[model samples]
Target: MAGTLTVWKFPTETGAETAVATVRDLRRRRLITLHDAAVVSWPAEATKPKTRQLRHLAGIGALGGGFWGLLFGILFFVPLIGAAVGAGIGALAGALTDVGIDDKFIEELKERITPGTSALFLLTSDAVLDRVLDEFRGQSPELISANLSHEQEDKLRRAFAE
Candidate 1:
């Protein structure tokens, strides 16, 4: 089955970290299944964001540090490196696109996840949409982006409608 790549943005820098607990609880209850997850915390005064992959939650087929590192580098570090590295960044970005994450997705993440914000990035499947979303009500997470198949997107929309 195709897993959904989702990014949820939170207003506070620590919000994503706090939501991790809720996600863990949901997983324990079988409300959702996560293949891999990561958090990006950007402080207001900081030059860049800090990223942490949830190693403990990673399953057998989960993506490793290398994937996160490359993604984060492309998202947060590429600008600082300048056009001199454009060629390399392009190649790396192409790799990401090959896996369903396109430029539009990356650009949206860059635009939304500004300083003083935090985002939870999840690679998941088999989610009980309504129940999973209900668990995050307290945090008020904004669904920034999601790469889901047509059927999955329809299911998500229906879940929200109800």
Candidate 2:
């Protein structure tokens, strides 16, 4: 059987929690498969700094987003000594935060997410687009389908063939 792989595009502003929650509810009712619920996220502000200095956060991801959040919280508390330590910790956090997604990763994703580019993509390999369409209907109302160019699709086929 020929399986259709759908790369559904969505608004970059779509909240991860909301999307996941909707899918989870649908799954509970057996409307879709676990595979159909897969998700990948790119910044909504693809061209701008997202979350915070994300463009420069290749330094932060290495330290892990959580670590910096912790350091920042610690810095916020304490007293006068906290100010100095907080600054140091924040510097470390910034350095750590800058390490997650590198410039190349952002550049690649951003190019794909240019003003008229795909903002979000949720690919599923199955023959149930109708089911998906019905399930996600009105949920992500602004989400649109990214029509892959023939060249793009052909390239994909060739890559998979190899």
Candidate 3:
């Protein structure tokens, strides 16, 4: 099921940073999917812009701390549980880190945050627009985009065009 669309405007200097932060923020909000997002404007990468955009890291501190803390808690109360869970998590994180895209992904994300761009976050879910929009509106970023169907995005676009 789906509901009316909503969007949020978070100021940033780079479109790349906006994408990263939007992904991270929505995920934290328990959103599992994003319909679409585009950088309407971005400073040419070759020329560094003077304005700086606010940045957000995905599952960064919270995710990191939660992962490690879970292991510690289990380890403290249940040695076997801790050992198994800790090893599992460590391995997954390691594998993801070892993957070729790990460094590049991080570097790219870093590049997005440099300055003076804004990120528009698009969300698709069953929840009411006000439920989410109210929260972001309170934060007052830049502009929020809502309810993006491929049909609406491009008159000729079909459901599976992507």
Candidate 4:
């Protein structure tokens, strides 16, 4: 099966960074395959934070790059009252919604991940869920899984929404 695009929101930047590093360790041990990964950290003082693309993972292509770019664009580039620009971006985001990532989700994430928080965006496969969860047991991160069926997504959400 193709891997799912998963976003895990961590309450702290350190928690998110730790998750990414642990995933990297798993990848190094050949336990999982990470297609691409990025980390977003928004400090309380900064207006916006950069979404950093990890170096060791495979290419995420233009679609993934554009998706993240558009997210950051909406958060930092578009003017607050630029209806025309907002509509254009909305249209583009709507078009890409079928691709499994969209503006609505992005906006929801924007609301959920506030300043002083962080998130991990990962494209992964062959994950050992037990092991992965073990690494994060103490952190209690919130998960927002994408590219999954409604049932699957619901199950995942219920499992990690703590």
lDDT tens digits, residues 35-68, model 2?
2222333454453322221212121112233432
Worst 10 residues of 1 by lDDT: 153-162
lDDT of candidate 1 over 1-162, digit per residue (tens): 557877889999999999999889988988888878899999999999999999898765677787788789888988888897867888978866656678888898889998999999887888766776788998889886556675553443333221
Alpha-carbon RMSD of each model: 7.1, 14.0, 15.8, 7.3
Residue ranges of candidate 2 with Cα displaced over 4 Å? 1-4, 15-17, 36-38, 47-112, 115-127, 140-162
Which scores better on TM-score, 2 or 4? Answer: 4
Q: Which prediction has more favorable TM-score, 2 or 3? A: 2
Candidate 3 residue lDDT tens string, 75-142: 22233456766667555444434222143433443344334454443334444445444445434454
All candidates: TM-score: 0.87, 0.34, 0.33, 0.75
TM-score of decoy 1: 0.87
- Tell me which residue pairs clash in candidate 4: none
Model 3 worst lDDT run, 10 consecutive residues: 53-62
Global Cα lDDT for candidate 4: 0.67
State how far residue 42 of model 1 sits from its true place (Å). Answer: 0.5
lDDT of 1 at 70: 79
